[model samples]
Target: MKQLMQALIDQGARLIGLVGLPPMGCLPAVITLTSPFSPRQCNESLSQIAIDFNQKLQSELKAMQTDQGPTIVYFDIYQPLIDILQNPSQFGFDETNIGCCGSGLIEATFACNVGSKICPDPSKYVFFDSIHPTEATYNYIFKKMQPVIDEIIQGQ
Candidate 1:
């Protein structure tokens, strides 16, 4: 990823925005697979991997930000996602353990199609399906990322 970003810089790109991975362990699909209980929770081990990967990416990006390198901005999407999971009520989401579409367990993409059962209120759920977030979740993340994005745009 760093190499590709650097190559883009070499190709005359002045600004590069890198969005870090979200908390994969906290995803409904991952919880269903890893959790032993009925109401699944986040798999800490899996979450750790995402955190570690993001940290490594941040470190590498910092190292690569020499005088010749392009202005690279690392947008930390992990923390805000984690915050939403931990405090769903604060984010106006009532469901954090499961998704809004289908059974809210393993359904994703095609499985969450027309015939699938959906929740009455999608806004109450953080995820649209097992692997994907709802529009509200994305909007919340975008709002949280705005300050960093603005700073980057201002060259701060």
Candidate 2:
């Protein structure tokens, strides 16, 4: 991660925003793939991996930030996503465990087509498909990242 950041910096990138990894364990696809019998539950082991990686990346970014050179900001999506998944009601989400398309487990992309089964209201669901979030979820995520985005724009 540091190497990649350095590469980008070397290429004359001044301000950089590093987005943390979302909770893959909490994703419907991962849940379905990892726990077929109990698709509603998240795969903790996968989520822990993302958590550990985010911690290391955050620590590295903190160390990289100095008064002398380029500005770097760590935009956290992991914690906010986890919070939304854990407490869907807070974010006006009725369904957190599954997506809105098809079975809301493993179907995505081509499989989740126009003719495919979908929920009546996608806004109520956190995910649109197994791997992607709904517009509403992205809106919530954007709200969480707005301050950082504003800071970036203002700094520039």
Error at 95, model 1, angstroms: 0.5
Backbone N/Cα/C clashes per model: 0, 0
Model 2 clash pairs? Answer: none
Top-TM-score candidate index: 1
In the range 69-148, model 1's lDDT, one tens digit per residue, is 67877898899889999999999999997899987888999999999999999989999999899989999999999998
How would you encode candidate 2's per-residue C-alpha lDDT over 5-78 as one tens digit per residue? 88988899888888888998989999888887843688889999999999999899999888865899888888
**Residue 12 shift from truth in candidate 1, angstroms:** 2.2
Which segments of model 1 are wrong by more than 4 Å?
none
- lDDT value, residue 104 of candidate 1: 86
Quantify how close model 2 is to the true structure by its C-alpha RMSD in Å: 1.7
Per-model lDDT: 0.88, 0.89
